[model samples]
Target: MPGYEAKAAQLAKMGADLIRPSGAPPFMLLGYAEERELIAGWAKKYGVQMFTSGQNHVRALRTLGIKKFVGATYFPERMNRVFARYFADAGFQVLALEGIDAPFAEVPKVPPEKILAFMKETAAKHKDAEGIYMLGSAWKTVEIIDRLEKETGLTVVHAGPARTWETQLRLGLRHPIQGYGRLLAEMPG
Candidate 1:
């Protein structure tokens, strides 16, 4: 993950190529924030609508009027800084940013209870944060979203569910889904 921006862009292009033959516009949820511009520009060439997890997270935050947030993730400290910078660049005030420092392969293995505890602890420390932005899609963060929001009294946005909500909205799917989070359960999809 040292040169993730370039690697992600490369993978996005390869994915676009695979979808091109089917004549369907390429829609991807590249989890990294750093590769958005590169992938978006490339997608634009083919009139494709590229969806990155960071973009979807930012959109969901904006939709819920969360201008200040604490960013938590199942990533290393360096990647946490990258996500912090990404959110700041997108015009949000990042109150705090931290990660579990877990390896990529270990992300999926992180328990839902740990994810909940991390977010809850982060939220408690950053009481001024309007929301909690949970980064990383491969983990079981979605399952604890509602509970975290309820316990912390902070709007919670997790990457995996946010991407699904955004994609569903773009696809004209307007049904509200419960338990995942407010973005999916309450937002007008």
Candidate 2:
């Protein structure tokens, strides 16, 4: 989470295709207000596109008129609670939450199946939830979102692919990816 500016610049210079910083600690530890913008600025200095964590999800939620959510996260309770505030500030109601409290290094080890289970379990608590949130980018969720939607009958929004969804709308790239979820295939674009 430290030296993300230098690290992002280094990766950009090395020809990384996109800059997707995939965790909250960098933003949480640095303080999202000023430092988050600083991180975005750093990415731009090197001609890279970045999807800052919570912002991407917020854009999707706002665009889709998703106001109620059930949250599942790989972050510890403290950090996840911080994210809850962000959701509240955006005028979304968090019906309930379930999380791992796992350390950052252990997050990726959480299987996609486990991710599905957590989301489904939390979604079950509030069938009225307008959307479901998967808050950690490190979780291997690429293969689970669509299945989770089928299993839970809720629109699942995730952290990792948030940019592509938001950018698609920004650039009017509306065709769905086919496997992820309505947010990708069927969002208003």
Candidate 3:
């Protein structure tokens, strides 16, 4: 809910119409009632479109040209069901959902191999797959994206990767990228 409010406020400040009283805006969010209400209020105040937040994170696949995502569920027995339902609804076949150490600030050697293996397995199953996606902001994946991509000859997209891409995509500015695996530091959206 807090995240919803914050995101709504961000959209409002960016000149998006949260209320959409008359015209359509860029996008709409679909989600929980309480969170939706808060976003609605903000959207209304800022003239932004208001709607429910979709629970299916698989929409990211459509946006990012990504297939086969691996999400970490540390010490959770029932979370997979929820993830499965959500992803299945969004038209994604779940690749792997395994537990890994959290808050990966420093590069962990062991987990990279595990992640790589999972990506490989997913790629094998889905013959037409492009690359793998790793979720979770706290996981330090930027450090490994390049090596993984080079070694596997596949794109490795991460949560943090979008920030650099956003700058280029929205502002249309290009910058030299270096030192991070195969991913150009500033991909042109």
Best by TM-score: 1
TM-score for each model: 0.78, 0.75, 0.55
Of 1 and 3, the candidate ranking higher by lDDT: 1
Please give the lDDT score for candidate 2. 0.74
Q: By how many angstroms RMSD does model 2 differ from the true structure?
A: 3.5
TM-score of 1: 0.78
**What is the C-alpha lDDT profile of model 3 across 122-155, one tens digit per residue?**
5556555465555444555676777776766666
RMSD of each: 6.1, 3.5, 7.5
- Once fitted onto the true fold, the runs of candidate 3 whose alpha carbons sit more than 4 angstroms away are 6-60, 69-77, 101-129, 171-176, 181-188
Error of 2 at 187 (Å): 4.2
What's the lDDT for all of these models?
0.69, 0.74, 0.49
Could you tell me which 10 consecutive residues in candidate 2 have the lowest summed lDDT?
27-36
User: Candidate 2: which stretches are off by over 4 Å?
Assistant: 1-22, 28-51, 101-103
Of the pair 1 and 2, which is ahead by TM-score? 1
Candidate 1 per-residue lDDT, tens place, 1-189, comes to: 235335445655666432111100112122334455555665665454555555677789999889999877665666666667777777899988887867878888888898888888878888799998877667777778889989988888887677767777776677788998788898643
Residue-wise lDDT of candidate 2 within 86-187, one digit each (tens)? Answer: 677667898875686567798888878777777777788787998888776678887888888888777778865566777766564676677988787776
